[model samples]
Target chain A: MVDVPQLVEQARQGRPRAVARLISLVEGAAPELREVMATLAPLTGGAYVVGLTGSPGVGKSTTTSALVTAYRKVGKRVGVLAVDPSSPFSGGALLGDRVRMSEHASDPGVYIRSMATRGHLGGLAWAAPQAIRVLDAAGCDVILVETVGVGQSEVEIASQADTSVVLLAPGMGDGIQAAKAGILEIGDVYVVNKADRDGADATARELNHMLGLGESRAPGDWRPPIVKTVAARGEGIDEVVEALEKHRAWMEERGVLARRRLARAAREVETIAVTALRSRIGDLSGDRHLDALAERIVAGDTDPYRAADELVEGLTNGA
Target chain B: MVDVPQLVEQARQGRPRAVARLISLVEGAAPELREVMATLAPLTGGAYVVGLTGSPGVGKSTTTSALVTAYRKVGKRVGVLAVDPSSPFSGGALLGDRVRMSEHASDPGVYIRSMATRGHLGGLAWAAPQAIRVLDAAGCDVILVETVGVGQSEVEIASQADTSVVLLAPGMGDGIQAAKAGILEIGDVYVVNKADRDGADATARELNHMLGLGESRAPGDWRPPIVKTVAARGEGIDEVVEALEKHRAWMEERGVLARRRLARAAREVETIAVTALRSRIGDLSGDRHLDALAERIVAGDTDPYRAADELVEGLTNGA
Candidate 1:
């Protein structure tokens, strides 16, 4: 309804309200959000997208809040998309993360948005990335995307970001297994949050040991830096920020940035493709042809792949 | 390649080897697994599908192993599908779950197979239920679907099972958040897996308090029983088994089982529809027309929904 392009331009000029309005529009309104995103896509890739993810009570939000506040201290505008997983039935936060993070509400230099993983099968998918784009286009220097917790979805959040931080806590035994299952591969920097807690050192040592066992993909020996932080108290916050910068430098020095950029483009293309495919599929509603195929497949009359192939050929060949 | 129908008949006749082979075939060969499932669908609803999921290192495998051994002691032939998150690179277990579970390998009364979460985005999907079906058709009195550590993917496992048991450890801080995420709602039974730990009682109390906050969905005070167990030592194993049986009865008596069947059927149908649609779009893989539309959508000249409509209409009208 609003002059979105004009508002986008205003946001590009660093208007905080315009930025906030743009993010809200992009997140809550899907169709309109896509329209705004189309206008803003070219303006993206400017902000360094940093993803921070960990288990619940691992102080991810607290760490991210500290990071936002820290970046602001250095005169860098920051945008935080704190992804929250809500009770799907009740539509309420188990922990009101957004409300707890309301301390930054008055700081114009800092923009924080709490995103409830709405309607999507997983938290922080379509809407979350689009929201980041809005912030990125709005002239934010750093865009922090925080996930609800560590899991497969958390790894996804890492994939979308320019730099991925896997947060770990003390006392979770066999943390190595958690790391080995795709988490270790995704992290550019590992933060042992709540460092004041006992066993944090041991967790860090275990992570370093595990990191040693794995082969590094990046050239020039890019070991993911492990930083210790008590995010709630803002202790060791500067080191975490420095580690992020150092990781970026390492990537740049090794020419991994170019590779990362190419990967990002491919990912961007794939994300749009998958989204378009899903949306197109939704339009089929309940086609009798599809239902029959399902029955045949379920009845052992046909294989799923073969049935899939038939459906594809039939549709594509102008059935 | 073995005679699936014959094997199904043997499983129905309560042959454990035949049941084990049936599950193995499903696990190793998914395409053939579907063929086998189609043959076995009408034969389902015979075995109770029980899912065990929680955070890693919380003794889920041990608990499952104990449960399977207990059920066997009671003369019940049990089938165990331990779903391990397969390494995306190595295509093997991140942890040696199967090795830990290999105790039942030589036992005639038990069938234990570790399944890798192949190509599944998170915790477990399609494969979990498909494997369960093989066991059910093979006429196992109890089918235990064991999932590695809790996260978003873990939630999917709950929906797949008739009775879901959520395992929790004593030291995992803020156990309440796990409960608050509606895990409490899905769990038919709750197990404190490592009761020897210091905080086990606290975790149990937290679970009970969380459960108490939710309104009872079942009739006549059907509160999910919370059983404490040191699964490694097999302590409280009988209580866990009793809890599962009691929960299953509650489901049947309250007509929840029938409703669950309908829900699962609907879910399976939806999955088939989506997979079919994905394949159809996939067929247009090299076509310039779809790619051009994607570019337009990405360029903001067309909205995703309208693009979807165009795609559907194009397919229907022979573009």
Candidate 2:
């Protein structure tokens, strides 16, 4: 017996070790995950998920640390999940983020976890929403999911957040890349950190310019406001929080917040379903069936499309 | 009839216009892809696939174009598939590569095509294999798949090629990053492009040291030899080509070449099958089924894991 109910209760009581153990179950994709999720499901959905993303070296960790401090000042329990999807050297990079935020470690109200691929289930992003549910159930008033802004991974991260904050630094060429990578579209609030540096105002101007050319949201669509900060010194964080709160209010008023939560739940179910199907695809029967089709296709007896049809058919039939 | 057979014939006759149209079909992911893949299956396995990859701005395009020229000098027809897996900014960046290689555009013996997304389906890498098959059937002696080695996309690129070349530039701090990203493992040949740069040798030395610690292949396994090159000036290309040739021969000798092709084909088939399953997940009767599950999960009537099971089951049960 894994004692999911007891652990969930302990987690609700803000026991750090219990929270860590529960998240570890999510990371490990242990068999008991179903029970844990079932146990924690009713208690979730209260915490606000704010996603912070930026190109590496853009001071995302520092900005996130600053945000945590500001939220703590409001007396809100905050949970931080720092996800590093780019590097397999995740341990070192994730450690750096943790060390930067370690000043808050003594406070039990702040629960910080750094996630890398403990095991590759497509990506660590896939496990994130589940871990988020744990934190949400554990009484965190806010949960921040921070990830390196890269290709497809960033899109997944944005999907998980209720309010997405796109961070940048002066002279990183991130403004133009942001427009190109479609980061501008996903962001609800933008921050140009390292505001003390030269070119900071220019970076803000450029991001604002790019946002101007972005897709026009519906008539009442929220405009993303860009704020500059020297996150190194925790300057401008209150404004960042203010913008986040404004966006949260806007999203909720527009029902976009509810839709986003629904979409997140939908994606979570889809990920699990797809993962199950994928795992089922590797059984001895399925492997042989797939290899047989592949052999025929390679031997020119059939094409990939038809073989795929047969394979999908096999999934429901004979084994 | 769309004259797919005639187009295939024209392409095989080495008509650049015809080859370009066929590759366009690949980029568009036209339904005729099945017919084309069946037609090209046997003709593939003739051309050698050399994957050239590195961090962007490391001159991967220059190296690839230089190799195209060297192969053409030997009177061998070559094909280049420039896969821009980065952002939408890929259009301009990839164009630069094509323009540089356009010097040979009139030769008729070289085929260069760039594949950027017409849409988002996570099928960017999937299209490359089919395109490679088209090039093989079109009588190219060598088909180079060039991609920006940023993250998981690079790994996918490596898996598609028979000989994977890892390119680096001095001062990119890429040597260590490469090790962290697991780039050091997939490479069959390594090149330090822009060897004339101040820190080139030091980069080479560091790469060699990392490679030294890398796992040894079988006793007779081919060691991925590191070669330095000034691709912009077309220097050291002959050695790069030689190393590629040597690796190809070694792979063939060890039967690794056959296994790799088999794996590639298997992956292609699996990608199609999985894509089919994924597509079946969110539409028609399936949409309602999933929404119902999602609603229940959101309401805590059931957990995501259980809802996922019901959804997967519903996928096979209904239309």
Candidate 3:
């Protein structure tokens, strides 16, 4: 209603409000958002998209804040999407993070946005990537995506980010929880946040031991680095950023980044195609003939493939 | 490799081996399996399907076994599909349940099969429904689906079955885990399994209290009944079966079965359509032109939807 395409264009030219509005449109899964993305596509891929994920109470926000401050010190424009899927308990915590990052509010060089997952599974699948697009288009050199660390949603970060950083808290039961959950395979860098806490070293050691147990499927010589961070006190933030840059460089050198990007694009296209096909087939519901075919399929008088063939034939040949 | 149509035909005539083969083929998601199901679809709807699910360690297997035994007592043949998804630590726990149901192996009237969910999320998605179809075609009067107690997969059970029974183990925390997780909304029959345990009464009280909080969304006079059961001792099995029967009758009287079966048929057809689209898109990887489009999308020069449009155009009209 607010000239969404015009806002997307303005956002492409580096307007903050326009960027915010564009992100909201994408997050809402607006039908026309894809058209705008097509227009803005060439301006992306420059930003270093780093995803930070871990279980709740792992200090991801503090570590992210420290990283933002560190990146800013080096004269880099930074964008942060601190993703918290809305829970009453986490809502208050996210508000605290908003207040914590307000120091950068006056700084044009550092832009921080909090995106709530809003019950979207796999950490706001469409919104997370689109937010990166906005931040990248707005000329941010680095975009940090801090995702809420629910078990299943965490994996989506691996799909969406250029580099994924998995955080773990100290004395949070067995480090085995992190290792056995397929989280070990997803991280491009692992961070033991709250390193000042007791048993932090032990957790890091456990993670390293577990990481060594699995074979890497990633096409690179780069093994994910484990960085310890006491984010509240701004300790070890530089090292994490350094490790990320190193991984990015290594991936580029090995051509892994380009290959990964291609795979991601192919997957996205397939998702779109599938969505289209599903919708088209969903249209069959309104037709009585199609309904009879469905009943026949359900009744076992005909197989689904034959029914599908008939449906497609009807669509193609105007049956 | 088997003559699937002949097997399907034999399955319709109540041959156990034929039924087992047909179910395996369908569960395998093999292309040929669709023909078998299409042919057998008219033969379905004879069995009343029951789904049992809850949090892990809730004694679902024991409860399911008891239900099977009870159904068998009434001279009704029963089929069970005990689905266990593979976890990182184990290949699958399906074999364990199969061993548990081994006591019923000698009984020709009772057929039990255990399935691994493989990579499918929400355990009940593919294999569970296929098993139900095969059993239905095999002339089983009752089909029971047992799911490993992950909350997300349990939601699928409600829509998949004629009557859904959510089993809650007594003294497993506050019973809030199942309630807060939305498992309570899905069950048509709530069973306090392991009712001999301490806090059994409290668990029943909590379930009743939660049930009272919701105005029934289920049609007609069919409110889900809460039955207490010590499945290990076979206590309260009769009441559980009675509740299942009453719910089944309620479903039939209100034409809910036809509606549900209708919905399932539509969903199955849609899934096949989506799968076909996936294969079509996957096959397009032979061309490098699509590769260029992907880079633009990742680079932020293109949005996914328009890129998809481009794909369609490229495939259909010479672009």
Candidate 4:
């Protein structure tokens, strides 16, 4: 049996393996997850979470590695959680991404882990926050949560952060694509990565134009700033970091950071509650109550809404 | 106010505008949806739902159009629900896809509607089945559900169909990509579209090899068959239709069709139930009960699971 208290102590001392184990428990929905979270809760609320998200091939991993280097140079312990919600089969693509971030793999002050949702019920919604908590309790000064692709789940994950960084690359159809993916609204700091490539200036210009088109901010409102960087060559990364810090400061001054964290906590709680309820509903199917309702619906004797009402009634009545 | 009975009557008589209006109501989650669904419950179960899905640039739209023509040739009334889950902006790309399908716009026997989730809470899960119900009640003998992109939502939407058709194109990196996207396990019919292109045979061979590597089927189990086609020119569509029919026959023979329908109905009911519960949970946040819990969690006084447990307990006790 795993020693939960011992594991928590090891993680708090910055033992990477214990942190990984806690995250794995969260990913697997292991029975001991509740205890782990309870033990870690008091130690969390310390790490500053910055979520980086963009389309594939947009240099997210490289930028993440660069950010790790930048943060470590300042003597801050950093944690990286690379989340892949797209792939169901875990570890393959995650391993490749970890390899790309291998320079930091051997650094004792840096903790890096790759997580795949593996077709979990809530995908990253249920897993990422807990993993972030683990990192936060592991004495990390900063945690970078990076997602692989631009999808609804990825956007949702990015929005959970205190500061969300949306990345784009030149000639990638990213300006309008970002809007369509709903990332434009969620970005606190936007990065035009691969800034040395052709049309870099145009991409940044178009992005600025697009971002300005729907502006309704007051004079003192926090406007999201765009940073240009060549993440591969580690060029302009410090500027990107500065933009992030400025955004963080703005959020802190406005009390937006506390509000965002509270909202994130609310969402995490709601997701867990819903997932628990769903598992109970799944149990109803095993007992043929749901099956009976389904048969009635399929036979046209009833509709799904009425059937759903019955299920909810049973659930709320402690069935 | 709309007349639900009259509208359902018009749809039963196959009036295209009535069908469109009913679908609009479903998409909008109109308050009268329960009444409409109750009225249409007995009228459904006639359409054979075939879901076509693949990555972008895999000729999904072309293959879907060709399949419509093939089914129409046999005098089958068809309904097409082109779902774009990836695009939150909606309408622009959906309109483009509709123009691609304009050749059937004037045909009274054909009903084509493009639906976008618009970032709805349950997304396509909540909308697609209800839309499918509308099309089925409108007297479509065959209904086609085509989703844009290869993502988790698209896979889910495809799986809701009676027979899921997974499309692929040569040189699309689709052989292994299929397995990674979790589409291989959900496909009831496989189509390699753009067959005239280079590496078509290699794609097919590689897909076959991958499909065979995980074989654990019994003697009478239905093996998913791969059909090659150049959908733009309408080549090999008849064979695709034949494969679909054979699979449908196999399912009916084993009573799998009825069972699949029952399972689908069960899922629909469960989603509706969960969505209703989620809305109630949302209400809790508005009243600050959830906010209090969230504050406690953020303050490290409690973990999310414990907070969620309290929330669920209140909900079950008629909170």
Taking chain B only, the TM-score of every model is 0.84, 0.92, 0.85, 0.94
Clashing pairs in 2: none
- DockQ of all candidates, in order? 0.19, 0.56, 0.48, 0.74
The reply for model 2, stretches above 4 Å from the true place, is A85-100, A179-182, A213-219, A284-287, B85-90, B94-99, B177-182, B213-218, B284-286
Interface RMSD of each: 6.1, 2.0, 3.4, 1.1
DockQ of 1: 0.19
C-alpha lDDT score of every prediction, in listed order: 0.69, 0.79, 0.71, 0.86
lDDT of 1 by residue, A1-319 (tens): 6788998999888788888788778666645666686678667667888987765557777788788778988999888777744311112433454555566767777777767654652235656666777887788899888775545555676666888988888986536545544666678888988888899999988888877735556556777888999987899889989999998888788877656655444344444445554444444325555556555644545544455455555544554
- Score candidate 3 by DockQ: 0.48
Cα lDDT for residue B304, candidate 3: 69
| lDDT for position A271 in model 4 | 93
Best by DockQ: 4
Collision count for each candidate, in order = 2, 0, 19, 0
Q: Write the per-residue lDDT of candidate 4 for residues A1-319, one digit (tens) a residue.
A: 7799999999888788988898888778899988988998889998899999887668788888899999999999999888854321124446655576777888999988777646677777888898899999989999998885456676788889889999999998877767766777788888999998999999888988888934778876888888999887899899988988998888889899999999999999999999999999999888999999999999999999999999999999999
TM-score of 2: 0.93
TM-score of chain A of each: 0.86, 0.92, 0.83, 0.94
Ranking by DockQ: 4, 2, 3, 1
> Could you tell me the lDDT of residue A16 within candidate 1?
80
Highest lDDT model number? 4
